[model samples]
Target: MSSNRKTLWQIFRAPLLLGLLSLTGLIGALVGDGLFDLISWATLGSALAVIAWYWAKPTV
Candidate 1:
């Protein structure tokens, strides 16, 4: 991949994944499936992890 593409991905990765996982969790909750519940929880954890990672970073 080109450097610019890589930079964009790095910049957007967490927010993109967070949005996707949150959407998936919302859909799973609406559908009321046990499997999806588990998936949602896992995604939720990872989403929190991403938030924590960014939050802990020192500002430039």
Candidate 2:
């Protein structure tokens, strides 16, 4: 496999994306709308995907 280098932001993208999505979901939840529920579920699923990606990554 080729050596791929990741910058600091790239390495930290998942939690950052999760945080932004969660914040958006929270704000939507506060507004009380069906759209927010979808956003929340999407955020949750994205979180799970991120977790799975890291869990299944190859170890050096």
Candidate 3:
């Protein structure tokens, strides 16, 4: 196999993490107020930041 080929973990890791983070944010926002509200916003905002970073990145 070529060294350039990505492992399954490498391919799936980011997407899996983003999905879990997004789920946590949604649930947090739904289940409480005050501190939970802040936690949910931070979690969700980080996810959005990651997305924006990817969207604005320069392509090879």
Candidate 4:
């Protein structure tokens, strides 16, 4: 693969994985009688922060 493709993958990997994991956790929280509300909110907030950081400092 081209270096550009590799770079793109690297750039997106973390956020994508985090997002997926967060979604899974949110779903789990919704189904179970745990602290789903807090967990989901916190996870969403952190994910938004990550996205903002990436948007502010995007690498070529």
Q: For each candidate, what TM-score against the reference?
A: 0.58, 0.58, 0.80, 0.49
| Cα displacement (Å) at residue 3, model 1 | 12
Instruction: Output the better candidate (1/3) by TM-score.
Output: 3
Q: What digit string (tens of lDDT, one per residue) describes model 2 on residues 1-60? A: 458998899878877889898787667767777887788778767877878988999877
Candidate No. with top TM-score: 3
Clashes of 1: 0
Please identify model 4 stretches exceeding 4 Å from their true place. Answer: 1-12, 32-34, 58-60
Q: What global local distance difference test value does model 2 have?
A: 0.79
> Distance from true position, residue 11, model 3, in Å?
0.6
Q: Give stretches of model 2 more than 4 Å off.
A: 1-7
Candidate 3: pairs in clash: none
lDDT by residue (tens digit), candidate 1, 1-60: 255545788888878978998888777766877888888787777878877988998876
| Error of model 2, residue 11, in angstroms | 3.6
Order of models, best lDDT first: 3, 1, 2, 4
Q: Rank the candidates by TM-score, best first.
A: 3, 2, 1, 4
lDDT of 3 by residue, 1-60 (tens): 356989899999998988888788899988999999998898878888998998999976
Query: lDDT winner among the candidates?
Result: 3
Query: Which prediction has more favorable lDDT, 2 or 4?
Result: 2
Q: What ranges in model 3 sit over 4 Å off?
A: 1-3
